[model samples]
Target chain A: MATILQFDFPYPGPWGEEGARALKDLAESIAAEPGLVWKVWTENEAEGIAGGIYCFADEPSALAYRDMHSARLASFGVTDIRAKVFDVNEGLSAITNFKIA
Target chain B: MATILQFDFPYPGPWGEEGARALKDLAESIAAEPGLVWKVWTENEAEGIAGGIYCFADEPSALAYRDMHSARLASFGVTDIRAKVFDVNEGLSAITNFKIA
Candidate 1:
């Protein structure tokens, strides 16, 4: 079953077009991460926060990525990271088109 | 273009098997809502909250539904109904598999 990983952290800037352009490489890297089916990048630049809802092939890969991400963020001095993972309720999800890839 | 609507509100129960069973009708009704593409149900049962990340056909439909939903929640005494709508960045999202359908 797939897993949904959601997380947010204190962040500022680089969420708009300019930021997207600047972060294209970073975005590409994330997209290429193994087991990551997709991600919806999220940000409230004005509120100084950013996160993403990620769909992963499974839980282990997602957790590994989360740990890696947390460590990376910590290296950059980001904190107060909040994260959670949920098992996809495929039957209920299908009703809402949460398709299984 | 698609829109993502995210919201959260306090709730004490009905997020597990029993709650889902009781809310089956509500879930079906929501799935049948016009302009709704899908909804990934979310809940932090321990924290007493429930919401979902909803994909809509367009921004207007999404906002319309949001307003309607807010009214309905109020009628049910659901306060603090937070909501936000975001335009899907198709290109960037495409890289992360946010297909525009």
Candidate 2:
């Protein structure tokens, strides 16, 4: 079963292009992690939040990535991050057709 | 079971606060729809993309929101949107603890 990981983080005080640039770099790095299938990155300026949906090949891969991401975000001075990991049920929708490779 | 809905859309050419504003309005409207539990909205300027992760009470509610959202986007001249729906497997992770209502 594919693992879905979702998370959101609030930008530190007075976020701007610089903060976004840093996040972009971080997101790109996470996307390259082994077993990562795909990720959708999102940001909301007015709300001062950013997050994404990620799919991984397995639970271990997803959990590993989550730990790495959380630590990286903390190092960047980003706090108040919320994350959840989910197991994808193939029978739910056409999502079974979505594959990483 | 809680239904997870994830989607992304490229903002129409040269998007700005105007596009985001319109999307906020649409998002707020969708959140009010019955059976919707929560939604996390995101945007990216450099990438020119916006999206969110949604939790719904059931499949029918999620699908209904999708149709409405698509039509609203079309009316706003947006195109090439991507969407996927997933059934949350409670046993997969701790996601079963996340609930609507």
Candidate 3:
């Protein structure tokens, strides 16, 4: 089973192209995390927030990564992160073609 | 490129296995919708909400489907759907191993 880790935090600027540039290496690195499957980079410039929805191999990995990511962002001077982890409904998700293998 | 549709609405009961059973047919049906790539069903039982994060073929398909979904949910006595659409940042998404194909 997989888990989804969703998080967001305040980022007043550097969205879209600029954000892409700033986070490119970080994005690539997270993609290489041991249990990671994928991530959907999310941003709402007008809403003053940025985050990603990540799919991980399982709950333990998801939780571990959440702690690691939260700390990493804090080291980058982003401390007010909002994070949540969900159990991926695999049986239901397959109906929408979400890759489970 | 893909468009991301994020939405949530009040649903106080039937989470996890029960929710899966209730929404299974709807999930299968939506999977067959034109331009839909995938949807990750989400729920917060304590928070009284249910929704999904969806990836679609393009922006127009996303918006069109959002309207259609809003209408459908309303017909099911669910009228207060909260929805937002985002243009997928393909380059950055690719960096995170998102399947943009």
For residues B1-101, write the lDDT of model 3, one tens digit per residue: 58788877887667788778988999999899889988888776666777777889987888898999998888988857877776666667788788753
Candidate closer to the true structure by lDDT (higher is better), 2 or 3: 3
lDDT of each: 0.75, 0.60, 0.80
What tens-digit string does per-residue lDDT give for candidate 2 at A1-101? Answer: 57777777885332334444545545455646888776655444555666656767888998898998898879988899876665543322122122333
Residue-pair clashes, model 1: 1
What is the C-alpha lDDT profile of model 1 across B1-101, one tens digit per residue?
57777767887665556766777777788898888988877666666777777889887998899999889888989988877666554556667876543
State the displacement of the C-alpha of residue A93, model 1, in Å, after optimal TM-score superposition: 2.0
**What docking grade does candidate 1 earn?**
acceptable
What does the lDDT read for residue B70 in candidate 1? 86
Which runs of model 2 end up more than 4 angstroms from their true locations?
A: A12-24, A95-101, B1-101
Ranking by TM-score: 3, 1, 2
Query: Model 3's CAPRI class?
Result: medium
DockQ of 1: 0.41
Best model number under DockQ: 3
- Over 4 Å off in model 1, which ranges? A9-11, A44-49, A77-82, B15-17, B44-49, B74-82
What would the TM-score be for candidate 2 when compared with the true structure? 0.47
Report the Cα lDDT for candidate 2. Answer: 0.60
Model 1 chain A lowest lDDT segment of ten: A86-95
- Each prediction's TM-score against the native? 0.77, 0.47, 0.79
